[model samples]
Structures are given as C-alpha cells and as structure tokens.
Target: MVAMTAAVGARPARAAPSAARLRAWGRGAVGAVILVAIILQAGAAPFVRGLAAVSVPSVVAALLLTAAATAAAAWRWRILAGRLGLALTWPQAVSAYYRSQFLNTVLPGGVVGDVHRAVSHGRSVSQVAQASRAVVAERTAGQVVQIGLAVMVLVALGMSAYAPAVGIVLLAVVVACAGVVVAAAVSTRARDVVHRELDAVRTAFGTVGTVAKVVVASLVVVAGHVATFVVACLAVGVDAPPQRLAAVALIAVLAASIPFNIGGWGPREGAAAWAFTSAGLGAATGLAASTAFGVLAMIAVAPGAAVAAASAFHRRRATRAAAVEESS
Candidate 1:
C-alpha cells in the first residue's frame, strides 16, 4: 500500500510541469490570436506613427508619472503586507514592484512578474500563502478603484452612448464571477481557502483608515496612469478635449487589464480604437495613442531592468558563495 501511494504521488509530481507548460502555451496562443486580430483590423500604420511621435520630453514625463504610480502601488502593498505580518518595507516594495512591472511588460503572460514578486516575498517570510494573498489583495483593491473611476467617468460622460455594449460586457462579467463564487462555495476545500483569503483581506483592509488609505493610493496610481495616457495622446497629436480623452483613456485602461495580450499589446489597441471611434474620433487616432502609451509605459518601467539585473547578479553571487562553503 505504501509503495502504491508513493507511485500515485509520483505520477502527479511528474505531470505538474507538463500541465503548467500546456497552460503557458495556451496563454501564448491566445495572445498571438489577439495581436493578429488587432493588426488585421487596425493595420500597422498607427504603431509607426506612435513611435515617430515620441519625444524626449514626453518620455521623461512618462517616466516620472510611472515612478509616482509605482510608489503609490508599493505603499499600498506595504500596508497590506504589514497587516499580513509579511514585514515588507516601502523601499523593498517599490523595488519589487518595479521589477514586476518590467517583467509584466516584457513577459508572455503579463502577470509573470507579479507572480515572481509574490513567490519571492512569500519564500522570504515562510508565509507563502499569506504573501500571495497580499499581492492579490493589493491588485484587487487597485482594480476595484479603477473600475469605480471608470464607471463614474462613463456615467458623467453620458453612459447612454456606450451603455448597451458596456452594460452587456459588465453583465457577463458579473455572471461569470457569480458562477465562480457558487462553484467555490460548493467545494469544501475551495471554501476553506476562500474563507482564509477573505479573513486575510478583512484583517488587512478592515479598518476604516486602512481602507481609506488604500483607496486613496489606488486613486493616485490610476490618476497617474490616466495622465500618462493623456500625454501619449498629446504626443501623437490627438487634439481632443481632456474630458473626451479621459473617457476613452479610461476605457482603454480597463481593456488593458484583460489578460489576453501579447506583452500588453492587443486588447488595449483594439479597445482604444473602438472607444475613440465610438466617441467620434478617428480609429487611427485611437491606435496611435494606444501605441504611444505602450511605448511610454515600457520606457517608464525601464528601471525595472536595472532591478532585475541586480537581482540576478546577487543570486549568482550567493550561489557561488554557497558552493564554496559546501566544498570547504
């Protein structure tokens, strides 16, 4: 019986990597499809135009805005981590956040960097699960704030113009989320995990002051992103009113959050094109703005490259030291 159990466990252990590989391949395929669709619909002219429009000043502004956003995000993470007993300092969180942003911008799955940050932090504290939950909470809080702001902008700009389509999309999302909740509630083990995560969330965000601070920080991050998008539009000579740009920009921001993207390329451009066209702006203009935004965003996260390089060098040094100690 002991041998049989051991064999059974070994089968899953061998299969795990294969399963992970399959999932990664699937995500890549989806991203490729989305990118292809965008190219076919929008053509490649806007991308070139966006690149041409980039200037030193615009890039500098993007970098500064990105830094501010990253700082705000790191601050929020620090608070959540502290509540979860993870002991992350502000500087550490900012560095990790920068590295994660760079990884997400360049990696196949836009979330790889975030996953790395969570796992690395968790390992350090030996509270892998809690650490992971902190990331989830931080990200979830940001998304909630973004969505709320988007809704407000949409409503203020008269939702009737975009209501039918946006409402349908939102309805589908709500239904899908409800289904997941029901499924989790029905599964005993899943329910336990959900309860634990919820408890962590409550502990981290339960206090009014903490909740307020998180919301404010998230708002700052969102505002920085929106400002960057506006800058991108201006660089590309969109020449639209701030309100109109803000509305379309918010929509594009929401679309970018969708997971199907080739290094954050596909859905964002498509959504931008759609949003701009719906708002009576040229689709090409939307594409140009989206392209510029993408470039500027990549530039803004350039610091992450330094952080990642330093991290790799440190790890190599540690490994060499460990090898020497082992030999001795």
Candidate 2:
C-alpha cells in the first residue's frame, strides 16, 4: 500500500513535466512545419541565391547598423535595470545584450538567450528576482515600442489586404487582457504577479524624461533593423517603392518577434514571403531577402560568440585561482 501510494503521488509531478515537454515539442514542430511549407512552396533556389548574393558592402552595412542598434537596445535595458535597482554599466549591458542576441540566433524558442542573460546578470547583482524583472520589463518595452512603430508605418502606407483582420485581432487582444485583469483580481496568485509586473513597468518609466529616452532608443533599434531588411531586399533585387518596402520589412521584423520560431527563422521568412507577395513582389524575392537578412544577422552577432568564449575562459581561470588561494 505504501509503495502504491508513493507511485500514485509521484504520477502528478511526472505528468506536469511530461505535459510541458509535449507542449515544447508541439511548438517546435509547428515551427518546422512552417519552414517545410515555405520550402515546398518557394523551393530552395531563392535561399541559395540569397546566400550567394551577399556582398562585402552589404555585410559592412549590416555590421555597422547592427552595432548601432545593439548600443541603443543596451541603453534601453540599462535604463530599465537602473530603475529596478539592478543597475549595470552601459558596456556591461551591451556585452550581455550581444551574448543574448547570439544565443537567440543559434537556439530554438528565440528567448533562451534573454533568459540566460537575465539569470547570469541576476546572479552577479545578488538580486536575481529584480534582475529577472528588469530583463522582462526591458523585453516587454521593446516589443511594445516595436509594435507601436509597426502600426504607425503600416497605417501610414499600408497596402495590406488584411487591415480589418489586424484591427479585429488588436481589439480581441484588448478584450482578452481585460478579462485577464478581471480574473486576476479574483485569483490570489495571478493578482500578485500581475500587480508586481505593473508596478515594475511603472517604476521603470517613472522618472522624468526616461520615457522619451527609451522611445528614442527603441526607434534607433527599429530603424537599424528596417534598414538592414531594406538592404537585404535591395541585394535580392526587389524594386518595390521605398515606403512599401519599409512597411513590408517592418512586418517581417514584427513576425520575428513571434516566440514559436527555430532560431528566428520560421515566422520571419514565412511572413516576409507572404508580405512581399502581397506587395506585388515575387514570393521568392521576399524569401531571398529574408534569408540574406538572417545570414547578415548571424554574422553581425559573431562577436558575441567570442565574448561568450572569453567570459567563460576568465570565469574558469578565476575559479582555479580562488581554489589555489584557499589551498595555500
């Protein structure tokens, strides 16, 4: 009876993790399906051509733009961290941000990088919770600003065929959020976390001029990404009007924000293909452009890989030195 009871109690615990694993696999599978569908629809020629089309000038431009964006993003993150009592210097934030970008580019789920950076930073500050919150707040703020800018771009020059659909989706989101707020008010656990997040956002934006500074930083990041995408499109010979191309590029960037992606591949490419097609550009052209953009993105973050290696080396060396000191 004792053994049976123990097994029965352990079943629920095991089931929870099993369910979580199942969901993760499901998400990955969806991402894979997206890529496979794109490949089936567009063929591999565009992708190969895209890789071939990358030139030295384009690579240099991408690197410079990426650096500028990384700096701005790091500044935004530092501002949020400062307000959260998890302050770190701008240089530290930039290195950590680069590390996160590299990891996100190479890893599945697209957010493993951010989580790693947050935990490591948290540990450094001896305030893991605050540091974690700062990261979350920073990411959340970036996404919000990006979406806001997307809406501005799209509305100003939208040839989008599904404007009504997008509006409906936004409306639905607002309603769902309201429902969540109501539900959280009645739920002890949900209320606490929701309130905590709300407080964190308020604190992060509380200071005079902080909001303007953050918005500027976010704009610089957005401009860099959009400009890089444009360069990719140009490299692939997409001859659409400047405004329309910018709109399509912004959409592609927003799609990259989707979490269910394989190293930031699936949604971005898929959306670009569709958006370009809608904009009267060939679907293959969009695929090629997005593919080129992805490659440039990887190249731009290559420094982060070096940073990760050096940081690991120093950490191991420090551990050994400490061991020796203790022994003596």
Candidate 3:
C-alpha cells in the first residue's frame, strides 16, 4: 500500500527547456517587436534616403573591419580559455568562440553562449563557473581600457564640454565593475554561490601568467571592436570627431549587454541616434550608421549558424553511433 500510494502521488519530472530553445523564443519576440516599431515609425521617405546614402566602399570597409574585430575577439577568448587551463588548441578555441557568437545572437540570454562554450571545451559545471570568472575579468579589463581611450580622445579633441557627465558615468561604471570583481576574488562564499551552475569562473585565478595574457588580449579585441564601430560611423558620413565616435561605440556596446533586446536592436539604435543627435548630427545619419553596423553584424554572424548546425549534427551522430555500439 505504501509503495502504491507513493507511486500514485509522485509525478515524474518534466524535462526542462533547453537554453537554445529559450534563446530562439527570445530572439523571435525581439524581432517581432522591432518590426512592429519600424512599422509604427513609418517615416518611409527619410528612412529610404538614409539607407540609400550607405556608400558601397563604406559598407565594404565596415564589413572588413567587423571581420577583423571578430577574429581579434576569437583570439582574445582563446587566450583566456587557455589561462583557465582548458586544453583547447588555437583552432578549437576560435571555432568555439565563433560558434558561441552565433548562439549569443539567436539565444535570449548572452550567457547561453558562454554556457555552450564552457561545455564544448570540456569544463565541469564548477570549472565552467571558474571560466566565467575569467571571462568577466577579461571583460572588466576591456571596459576600463575603453573608457580610458574615450576620455583621452575627448580631452585631445577639446570636447571637454561633454566630459564631466560622460566621464563621471564611465568612471562610476568602471569602479562598480572593479568592485564586483574584487569582491568575487576575495569571497569564497560568492564563488560557491555561482558554483556548478556557473563553474567556469571557479578556476578563475589558478594561473596568474595566463590571466595576464587574457587581460591584454581582451583589451586588444575590445579596442578593435570599438574602432570598427567608429569606422561604421564614418561610413555613414557622420563628421563627428573621434571622441564622439568612441562615446557612441561605448554606448552601443553597453546597450548590447541588456538581456531583453536581441543584440540590443532597439536600445542600440536608440542610443546611437541620441548620441549623434546630441552632437548636432541628424537622426537619419545616426540611424543609417547604426543600421549599417547591424546589417554587418547579421552577415558576419551568419557563418556561426552553419557552425552550430554542424556541431549539433556531429554530436547527434556520435550519440547514435555510441548507442548502436552498445546494443551490438
């Protein structure tokens, strides 16, 4: 009677939805909202004119720069993964990085990409959490470098008028981020909080030499990404000085960190529009530049979809083969 009652009362656990599936739903929702907003904005003539002004050479340059930025990013991540004591070869790291990029684009949560990369590189959940720590370290260092560059450019170009506000905000953000990293480093309890579920960050401080290499490489990658955004601005004929472009890049990149907006579509474009418009540029030009960057990103990430497909297929085939062998 006890066994029967227990069996009747206990419900079987339902399988949870995959991170990839959740990401797909999120991307679809974001795309739908953006489409609806575009329809409502419906100022057709200006949008058409702005898009038409996207020059061919400028587009080409934007594409090339984006590719370079992507490559640099892959290199940066590979270096970081090595520091975390992952045994990824150079090619493996680059491939995994690009694959993660595709996941990040289509998946709702940005960390979904990191999760996939962590598993692919053979990290245990705890190890993956440690690895995530390394990734955060790399990102924090890059943000600091970016803010410093923006401030320096603003000072050099006599754009000190906008400095106090933007500079203070940037500094505050950097300090907050630094505080978080420092706290994590000192807090074993915090490390345990994100344990198996975020384990890539656990082994985060194992090798100081490797960690330093990752920090430097990450800086170069982030700088390259910012430069590409600046080039995109030039492509759209924005005459703003370099400082302004840097500021715009910082705003756009920061916006992309938000989880809700499919690669930060609405927020990114809105930020660009506001930034450029404040500098006395037309919204149309800002939109064009932002749109160009978006399109380039879509194209650049297309290959990632193929990589993901292949990876899935290979994994499935391996599973089937193992099952067949076991049966035999």
Candidate 4:
C-alpha cells in the first residue's frame, strides 16, 4: 500500500518545459536587456551612489508602509478566495502571501506562487482555475487604479511642463487600453460565457463586503505603496511632493510585475529613474528611492524565512512518520 501510494504521488517528474515557460524565459531575457539599456542610459556610478546614501528614518517609514501594503494585498486575496468559496483566515492568508512574495522574489516566473496558493488550499482544478482568473482580475483592477493615480499626481504636481510628446504617448496608451477592454466586454460571446458562469462569478464578486469596500481597500493599498516610496524618497533625500510619489509607485508596481532581475532589482530601479526624470526630478533621486524601498521590502520579508523553515521541518517530520508506518 505504501509503495503504491508513493508511486501514485511521485510519478515520473521529468522536466517538461511548456510554451508558457519558454515565453517566461523570453520575458526574463527582455528584462535583462532592459537593465542593460538603463545602465547605459543612466551611467553606473550615479546609480550606485544614489542607492548607497539612503538614511535611517526613511528606512523605518518604508518598512512600516511595506507591512501595511502586504496586509492590504492579503486582504485582497482573502476577498478573492472568499468569492471562490475557499475561505482562509487573515493570518493564514497573510503568512502564505508573504511566503508567496518571497518566492516571487527568489524563484523563477513568479507564477509558481499562484500554483502554490491554489494547491495549499486543496482546491480542485476547476476551482484553482477560477481562483487564478480572479487573481488576474484583482491585478487588473490595481493597475487601473495605479494609472489613474499616476495621471492625477502628474496633473497635481504640474509636471505638465514636460514636452507635449510625452503627453501624446500617454494618451495613446490610455486609448489603446480602453479600446482593448471595450472590445473584450462588448463581444456577445464573451458576455454569454461570463453570464453562463454566473454562479462562480457571483461567488467571486461576493467574497468582499461590497464594491465600495473593495474600492476603498484598493485605494488604501495604493496609498500604502505611495507612502513606501515617499519614505524611500525621504531616506534618499529626494524632497519631492506627495503628488510625485504616484509616479514612482506606479512605475515600481508595473516593473515588479514583469518577471525579471531577481526580485525586481534592475527593472524597478530603472523604471523608477525614468519616471522621476519624466516628472522633472533627478534620476538619482528615483534610483535612491527604489533602492531604499527594495531594501525595506526585503527586510519586511524576513519573517517568511522562518515560515519556510517551519514548513520544511513539518514536511520532514511527516515523511519520517510515513516511513515508520510503512515499516510497521
């Protein structure tokens, strides 16, 4: 029985890399190229110096806000899970989220964390698929919020003084995204498919209290991200206004979502620098803020180290117990 169980569990674990894996690898390569481009454009010395000179208070503030941001993320996940009928406690969701974030930073593709979350909940394949779709929806909502916030911040900061060319480019992106969303939503087949799955859809949407609560929480999450960036700015002595914080925050979030540069190191910093420069701020300041934020985030993730250790120990003990049982 034990041998059979082991066989069923193990199978032949050959590495069958899929098309998706190949694409992810390609994206990683593109990310590396982006890093090289940023390095060439920005010059290496100023970047390094900017990262090195961050102060203590900024670090503290960034860490605090980072924790809040992580909590907000867990809250979002909880809402999604509840919608899917797989309810997890806040503490459980938060711990698992932190571990997932750690994995995204340390492991390849980052999608593995999604798989981990799905399997950890002991969900069926269809449930996992629905849950994964909801995660993507949540992410889309956050990005929409980020873009809106960035635009508002730009207007508020009077960064409109920059070349009209940039504004045109931004307008084009907005139009393109709007068009894509509209096209998808307006398709009768698409609407029918979505309506057909109303049960799952309603369940997913119902997890959170109301749309207003979700919106409010999303705002708080965005605010937390901006606060973290502002703290990083203070640490690095950037002296920018609260409005400018949105640029850095938006860029950081967008770049980090792209799978590359071990925990978002290269792209995050580079994109931040570009965002700052476009906002009429020095690239050094953006680089500094990005570096400080990254450092504080890594520190915030330290608890996940303990969680990982505990999980490993539990697995080992379970294995040993199974061995004893099999022998008996």
| Best by the TM-score measure | 1
User: How much lDDT does candidate 4 score?
Assistant: 0.61
The digit string of per-residue lDDT tens for model 1 on 1-328 reads: 1111112212343443344334434555677788788778778898889899999999999999999999999999998899888899877899999998997788654665666677668767876667777887888788778878888878987745655545645775688669658968899866775676568878999889999999999999999999999999999998777899998888888777665566777778888888888889888999999999999999999999999999999999999999999999
Candidate order (lDDT): 1, 2, 4, 3
TM-scores, one per candidate: 0.91, 0.87, 0.71, 0.75
**Model 4 lDDT per residue over 1-328, tens place:** 1111111112222221233344445555666677678778767775666567555766666667767877887787777666666667888777877776675555545444544554444343334445554554455455556556656665666766432433544575577658646755989864564454455556666644645555666777788777776666666677666666655666665566545555556678777777777877778667767777777667666676676677779889989999999999
Candidate 1: pairs in clash: none
RMSD for all candidates, in order, please: 5.6, 6.9, 8.5, 7.2
User: Candidate 4 at 266: error in angstroms?
Assistant: 3.6
Q: Which parts of model 3 have CA positions greater than 4 angstroms off?
A: 1-60, 109-111, 123-127, 155-212, 240-243
TM-score winner between 2 and 3, please give it.
2
lDDT of each: 0.79, 0.78, 0.58, 0.61
**What is candidate 3's lDDT per residue for 86-168, written digit by digit as tens?**
55566666666677767766655444565466545544333543454444444445555555655676577666655654555
In candidate 2 the C-alpha lDDT for residue 260 amounts to 69
Please give the distance, in angstroms, between residue 199's alpha carbon in candidate 2 and its true position after superposition: 1.5
lDDT of model 4, residue 313? 95
Q: Which stretches in model 4 have alpha-carbon errors above 4 Å?
A: 1-24, 54-56, 108-110, 122-127, 156-199, 206-209, 259-261
Give the lDDT of residue 326 in candidate 2: 100
